[model samples]
Target: MSLSELFISKELTIKDSLAKLDKTAKRILLVMEDEKLQGIITDGDIRRWILNNGDLNERVELAMNRSPISVYEKDVKKAKEILNTNMIEAIPVLNENNNVVDIIFWNENFNRKLNYYKKLENPVVIMAGGKGTRLEPYTKILPKPLIPIGDTPIVERIINKFNEYGCNNYYMTVNYKKNMIKAYFDEKEKPYQVNFVEEKTPLGTAGSLYLLKGIIKETFFVSNCDILIEGNYSGMLKYHKANNNKITLISSLKHYTIPYGVIEIDKNSIVKGMMEKPEYDYLVNTGMYILEPECLHDIPANTFYHMTELIQHYIDKGEKVGVYPVRENSWLDMGQFKEMENMIERLGVSNE
Candidate 1:
C-alpha cells in the first residue's frame, strides 16, 4: 500500500476509517496529527467495537490503540523481526523526528493470500430477476447477471467471493433472459451447487424471496446481481446472530459534496449559517442483506414488492433490523453505465 494511504486524521469518524481501510485493502491505519504519530487502528479493533455495539459515528481515536509498535528508519531492517515476534501484520517506520516516515507489512513482497475465518455453510440468494434498465443497450443483449466485470460475469464474481467462505449453495432468482443465465452456467462445471428460481412473473426484489421459504431454512444472504461488496462475509453473519437481528443490511459510507455555497434559513427568514462546498457523509444501502429464513414469510407470493418495504415491515413491528457498515469503496455498484466503468476499472477488467 502507499505510505499516504496508511495515514489518517484523529478527527475522522470510525465509519470513514472503515472506508479508508477498505480502499487500501489494508487491515491497519496510522493515526497522524500535526506531522506526529498518535496511534494505530486495525480491522480487529473496529470489529471488536462493532460486536460491543459501539456507535459507528464515534471518532476513530476512541478505537485506536494509544500505544503502537514502531521501528526507526535507520533500523528498518529489523521491522520483519518485530513483525514476526509480535505476530503482527504491520509496523510503522519512524525517522529521527519520531514521525512515521513509512509503514511495513510482513507480506509486502509476498503474493500469498490469507483467510481469517473458517468455512461457512450458509446459502446465498442472488436477486437476478431485474431487467437492469440502467444498463440499457448492454442489458438489451445480455442479462445483467451475465455482464462481465473482468473475464468472469458479475454474478459469477459475486458467487466466487462468497465461495471463499465455503458458501457453496446458492439460489438465483431469474426472470429477464432467464434462459441465457441458465445456459451459461449449464455449459460450465462448478464445484458449488447453483439452483435457479424461475420467476413466472415480475416480483420486485424481496417478493421473489418468498419462493425460497421452504428451501432456505437458516440464515442466508441476499445480494443484488449488479453489485459487488468486498467485506468479511463471516463477520457479517456473526454480527447478525450476535444482535439477533431478523435482517442486517450491508451499508457503506458515502460522501456527497455540495458544489455551490449553501445558505440556511430559519422560520423568520433569518440566515442561520452558510458554508461553501460542504461535504456530508451518509450510510447507504449496498444492496446486500443477511436474513433469517422466517423473514421470507412476509413477502406475498406473486406480488411486486421491494426489499425496502420488507425492511420497513420489520422496523414497524419492532423486529431487530440492523445494519453492518462496510467501507465506501468496498461496495462496487454496476447499476449504471458510469458505475459499470468504475467497477471494471476497480476489478481490473479489460475494456476490450
Candidate 2:
C-alpha cells in the first residue's frame, strides 16, 4: 500500500490516530499538513501516551514525534542504515521540500525471533471457578474449562501454551464442576505440577487469587480458563519487570465502526462537527495479567471482588499499572459458543 494512504492529519484526535494505526496495521502514521510532513505517530507513542494519562480526545500532534528520522530520495540506502542502527521498523522518506514522499519498511526477512530456551519458573494461576452460563447445555454437562477445543480441553490448551514457555507450575482456582476438572487431570500423567485451590463458593475473578497470597511470593501470571492469548509471554514478563509495574494488563486492540453518522455537540448545544460512519479503536482487557506478590494484600478476603476493582484500587493509589497492547487477532475469546466455534475452525480442530 502507498504511504499516502497512511497519512493522517495532525489535527486529528489521538483516538482518530489509533483507528488509523489499526486500519493500516503499519504500526506508524505520518502526520501531514498541506502535503508537508509535520511529524509522525506510532503505536508505541500512543501506548506511552495512554500510560501517562494522556486524553484520547487530544490532538495527535501532542503525542507525535516532532523530530522523527527521515530520509531523502537520494539517501534511500541511508534509510536501511537508520532503521538498523536505531532498531526501528519503518522510516519516512522525505522530498526536497520536506514533504513525506514515501515510507521505507524494514525487510521482514531480516526480522529475528528470540529464542526462549530458558524455562520461566513463575507460577501461573488459572481462574476456572466461574459457571459457564453463556455456553449452556454443554456447560450444563461439563465445566467451561473442560470443554473440548479439539481433542484437548480448553484449560489443558492454556496450560500447554505456558508449558511451551517453560512455566511448569500451575495453580487452578475451581468451584463449579470442580471435581470433574480435578478428575480429568488426575487420570493423566502430567509433565508439570498442578495444585488446586478449591473455592468454597463462587468468589469473583480476583477473589480466588487471594488464596495464593502466602504461596506465590513472586511475580506470577493470572489468566482466565476460557481465553487464550497468542503472543510473546517472555516479552510481557520482560516489560513487567523492566517497568517495575505492580500490575501489567494484556490488552487487545478492538475496532468498532459505527454504521451511522455521528454528531458532536458543545456545552451550548451547538453542533461542533459531524462524522460519517466513524470507526473507534479501544484497548480492551483480554483477561490476563502479571501481578506482583504485594498486589494480593489488597484483595478483600472472602469477598466477591473483580480484577477490574483491584486494578482501580491500585490506580486510585497512584501506583504504576502498565498495559501491553497486542493485535486484535492475537486474542481468542472462547467463553461464548460462537467464539469457541471460530477458535475451533482457526485451529483446524475437527468437530467430529
Candidate 3:
C-alpha cells in the first residue's frame, strides 16, 4: 500500500480517522498539511482518547502526537533500531523538505499479516439460540449461526476473528435447530473448542447465560451470533479490568439525520426554533459484552431476561458498568436482511 493512503488532515474527526484506519487495516496515520507532516496518530492514541471519554467528533489533533519519530533517510538499519527501541509499528521517512517520502513498517513485509494487538485467551460465548425471526426465509431453512456469509457461516467467521486473538474456548447456547448448528460444526475440523449449551426453550438474551454460571469462572465475552464487532478485543478487556468494572458493553457511535426539518417548541407552547434536517448522534449498544463471572448471578435461572435487565441490575446496585465505543462501520450486524446485505458487502463476500 502507498504511504499516502495513511495521510489525514489535522481537522479530521477521530471517528473518521478510526474508520480510515480500519479501511487501511493499519494503525498509524500521518497528519499532513500541504504535504508536510503536521502530526501522527496511532491506534494507541485513539484508545487513550476513547478511554478518556473524549468526544468522537473531536479533531485528530486532540489525540495525535505532534512530535512523531522519523528519519531523514530510509536507512533500513537505523529505522529498524528505532522501531524496535520504541516498540512502534511504523516510522515515517522524511525528505529534505520535511515531507514524508515513504513509510517503514516494523513488519518489513508490507503484505504480511501484522498483529500489533495482544492475543487474548478469554472464553467467548456466542448467543446462537435465537429463532432468528428477522432473517425469516433463510432462518426457515437453516439456523442463523449456520447461514453463510460467503462460503463460511456467520458464526464461524465470528469464531475465526476470536481465534486470531487466541481465544479458543467457546460456549454456544442453542435451541432452535440446535442439531443443524451442531452438525455443521461437527463436520468441520476446527482447532478451537466449541461447547454447545442446550436451552430447553427460547430464552431471552441473558436468560440462557444462567446455564453457564458454574461453567464460566472468569471474565468472558458474550456476543450475538449475527453481529461481528471488529475492534480491539484485547484492549476492551484491559479497559474493563483496569476500570474494575463488573460488566463492560461494546458500543458504537450511531448518527441519525432527520430527512425533514425538525421543529422544536418550548414548554409554554411557543415556537422555540427550527433546524433544517437535524442530526443526532448516540452511543448505541453493539450486543457484545465482557462480564466478570460473578455478574452471571444477576441472571436468574430459567427466566426470560434481556441483557439490558442484567446491565440495569449492576446499575441499580451502583456496581461499575462501562461501555467501550467503536466506530459505526466497525460493528457489522447481519440479523436482518438489509443489514445482512450490508455486512456481506462490507466483507467483500461473493453474492453468488
Candidate 4:
C-alpha cells in the first residue's frame, strides 16, 4: 500500500496500471522512451478515460498524465519536504528533463491537517481576440491563445492554474483564427466548460467584455491571453471584496537598477546626492482585473475601449478602484518579443 509498490513502466498496460493502483498508491510511474517522461497515469485519468470508452489493453502511455504536475530532480527532496510541510497528499517526482520518475505519497506521514482553501465563484474571461501585433508573424498564423508555452498552450496553462482554484467556467473572446482555437480545445475534450464569443471586429480590451455583460452577472476576472499572471487569484478577489471596490487592478512592482551612479541636483547646480546602481520599484498594470458587473455597462458597443480607459472612467466617477501588487516575476508577459523568446527557452516550448 506504499507509493514504491505502485511503480510501473510506461510500457505496461492499463491492466497493469489498474493492478498497480490497488497497491494503495493512487499514482504509478510511467517510464517511456528512454529517460524522457511520457506521463503519470492516475486512477482518475483511467476511470474517466475508460468511462469515455478508453481501451483496457492499451498501454499506460494512453492514459498517462502527459502534463503531470512535477518537481525537478534536484528539488525532489526539497519538494518532498515542502509537501510534508504543506501536508500535500501526493506529489509527483520528475528527473532533470522533467520526466516523471516516481511519486511521493505523504499520506502515511500523517500529521492530521487538511488544507482546504475555499475558492471564489468568479468566471474567468480571457481577452483572446487580439491579432497579437506584438508577436508579429507568429500571430499571423496562430492566435495568441494557441501559442505554446512548455507543453500546453498558453491559454490552457491559464485555465489549468485557475482550475486549481476551482474556477472552471471560462469565456474566451476570439476573432482571428477563432476556429483554430476552438478546434484545439474540441480535439482535446477538456473537462471545464468553455464558451467562445466571436468578435466580428476587433474590440480593444475592455470593449469585448461588453459581450459578457448579461452573460455574467457577478463580479468576474478579466485577463489577457498573452500574459500569464501567477499568484493567489482567489486572494485578489478577496482583496477586491474587502475594499468594496468596483474594480481591482492586478499590478506588478518591477525593480530596475541603474548600471552607473546617478546624481540628484538642486536647480541644475552641484550634485546633492549620488548613489550607484540604486534599485527603484514602480507599479505596472498587469492587464488583469476583477470588475463588478455594473461596471460593464460603461463599455461602448462595437467601440474600442482599453481597460485603462475603463479604470479612468470609473476613477472620474469617484467609484472605488484598488490595485493589488504581485511580484514582478509572477507576471509573465509572453506577448512581447523578448518575453516570448525567454518564456519559450525557459519553459522548453517544443513538443516532447
Candidate 5:
C-alpha cells in the first residue's frame, strides 16, 4: 500500500497518533483492522494542521479528510492516467473490497528508463567564499570548505548532497582569498559543472545570488559550504513542490538536555510545575535552501545580505516560506572547531 493509504483506529487522538505517523514515514505499515482501508495520515498532514491552528490534542478523525482518493486493483492504467492528469507523483492501489493493496510511483515505474539520462535541470548556488573566522587559527590558512573531512573536502560533501537529486550545475560565490579555492578545485578536476562568481569584496551570504540573476532561471538549491546533510534532497524538493513555496529551508531537529534541575515559576514565586533536567527538541536550520527565481530580485547588488534577513523580509511581505525537518543526526555543522573535531572523530572514517 502507498504510505498514504494506511490508517489508524478512529479512537486515537491526534496527539497520541503523531508518533505512529512519523514511524510510518520510516516504512512501517499503519493498520487497525482486517485489511480495511481507512484514510492515511502523513507528516504533511500534521504540518498542515499546525499551519491551520488545529489543536494538538484534537482527535485525528476531526483533522483527517474523509473520502480519500483511491484507485482500483485492475485499474493500474487508470491510476497512471490519474497521476498524470493531476500531476501526482504517487497513487494508492485498492483491492475488490476497497483495501489498499500497493502503491505505484509514476517516475519509478513508467519514467525510470527516461529519467536515467534526463537529470533534474536545476542549478546549485553555494556560498563557499567565506573565510573561516569562527574556526580561529584554521582560518589563517585554509578556507572552511577546503578543510579535510577524511578524503574529500567539506564543500564536496555539500555538493554531493545536491548531486544525489540530479542537480549538477554549480555556481560557487567566491571571495576572501578566492585563488586558494580556485587552485584547489583546479588541481583536483571536480566532477560536476563548477563555475565561480567572483566577488570584488566580501559580500555576505545571499548577496552572491544576485550575481546569478540571469544564469539561474528555475528553482535552485543554495547551501553553505560547511554543512553535511544526511536527508534526501529529492524528498525535500517534493515537499517544496507540494506546498508551492517560494523558498524551502531545510531544518534539522536538535535536542538539548539541561545540565541542572529546572523549575517552573508562576506569577509571584509560585511553582506551577517542576521538572529536573528537562530535554527539549528544536528545529534548527541546516543552512540549505531552495529558492524560486523571482526572489533573486530582492537581493541587493554588492551589498551584505544574509539568508536570515531575506527570509524575514519575505515573511513581513507575506510570502510563503516553508521548512522541512530532518532528523537530528542528519545534520553535521563543521563551521566550528569542536564540531569539526567531532565530525572527524565520529564521521570521518565513513566519509573516507
Candidate 6:
C-alpha cells in the first residue's frame, strides 16, 4: 500500500491514529493538513503519551513529533542515508512546500540484521508455585502456569520469549501441582535445559530463590509464570549491568482514570479546588526482575516471603534497586479473567 494512505489529520484523536497505525502496520503516521506536513506520530510517541496518562481522546498533535526528520522528494537518497545512519525505521519525503509526498522505510533485512541480540547464559527462575486463586475454575483442573493461551501454556510462552534472547537455562519454582509442570517438560523433547525446584511447602515468591544460593552464580532473571513481558529483555539486562544495580524491576506503565470529580481540601477543611475526573499514571511491577546472584542470599530459607519484601529489604539497606519501565500493552497478565480475555483478543485466538 502507498504510504500516503497512512497520513492522518493532526486533529484526529490519538485513538483514531492508533487504529490507522495498526491498520497500516507501518508503526507511524504522517500528520498532515492541507497536504502540508504538520508532524509525525509513531507507536513510540503514542506509548510515551499513554505512559504519561495522556487522554486517548485528545488530538494526535498532542503526542506527535512536531519537528520530525523530513527531506524533499528530490533528496530521497538523503532520506535513505538518514534512515541508515541514524538507525531509524522511516523518514518522510516532502515537496518544496514542506508537504509530505512520500515515505521511505528501512529495509526489513537491514532491520533484522542490525537488531539481532547475542544469546545469554544466565539462568532464568520462574515463580510458578502460586495457587492461582484468581483463575479458579481453570486452576482446579490445571495449574496456573499450565493454563493454555492459544495452543501453548502461559509459562511456556514466557520461556519462549526469553529463549529468543538466548536465555536457555531455566529454573522453575513449583509447589502447587508441581508434578504436572515437571512432567510436561519431561515429556517434551526440547533443546533448552530446564530444572524444576520443587518447594516442600508454600514458599512465597522470593522465598524459593534461597534454594538457588550456589546454583545461580551470575546475574539472572526472575519472572511470574502467569505474566508475559513483550519488551526487549536484552535492554533490561544491559541496563541492570550498566547501572551496577543489585536488583532491577521491570515495571509497566498503567493509567487509571477517575470517573467522578475530585475535590482537594485544605487544613481548614475548606475546598481548595475541584477538577473533573483526573487520570493518573503509575509504574506497576510486572513481576519480572533481573538480579545479581548475590541478592539470592537475602532470601530466607524455608520461609514464606514475597518479592516485594525482598525489594523493601534492599531499599531499607540503601541498596541499588532500579525499575525499568515499558509500555502498558507490552506487559500481559493472563492470570485474571479480564486480562485473559484481553490477551485472547490481542493474540487473535478463538475463545473456544
Best by TM-score: 3
The per-model lDDT (C-alpha) reads 0.87, 0.86, 0.86, 0.75, 0.74, 0.84
Tens digit of lDDT per residue, candidate 1, span 1-352? Answer: 4688789999999878887887778889999998899999887677667656677789999999899999999998887678767656778889999988888876663332232345789999999988999999999999999998878999999999998778899999999999999999988999899999999998998999999888899999999999999877877888789899999999876778899999999999999999999877677899999999998888888899999999999999999998887767788999999999999998887868
Q: What is the lDDT of residue 267 in candidate 5?
A: 85
Model 6 per-residue lDDT tens digits across residues 113-132: 21223567789999999999
Clashes of 6: 0
Off by over 4 Å in 5: 1-118, 270-273, 345-352
Candidate achieving higher TM-score, 3 or 6: 3
Residue range 247-279, candidate 5, lDDT tens digits: 999887566779888989988999888788986
Worst 10 residues of 5 by lDDT: 23-32
**Can you tell me which runs of candidate 1 are displaced by over 4 Å?**
1-23, 32-38, 43-60, 67-117
User: How many steric overlaps are in each model, in order?
Assistant: 0, 0, 0, 1, 0, 0
Rank candidates by TM-score, best first: 3, 1, 6, 2, 5, 4
Q: Cα RMSD for candidate 3?
A: 2.8
Model 2 clash pairs are none
Model 6 stretches with alpha carbons more than 4 Å out? 1-117
Better of 1 and 2 by TM-score: 1
- Poorly placed runs, candidate 4 (over 4 Å): 1-119, 268-274, 345-352
**Model 6, 110: alpha-carbon shift in Å?**
5.6
What TM-score does each of the candidates earn? 0.81, 0.71, 0.88, 0.65, 0.70, 0.78
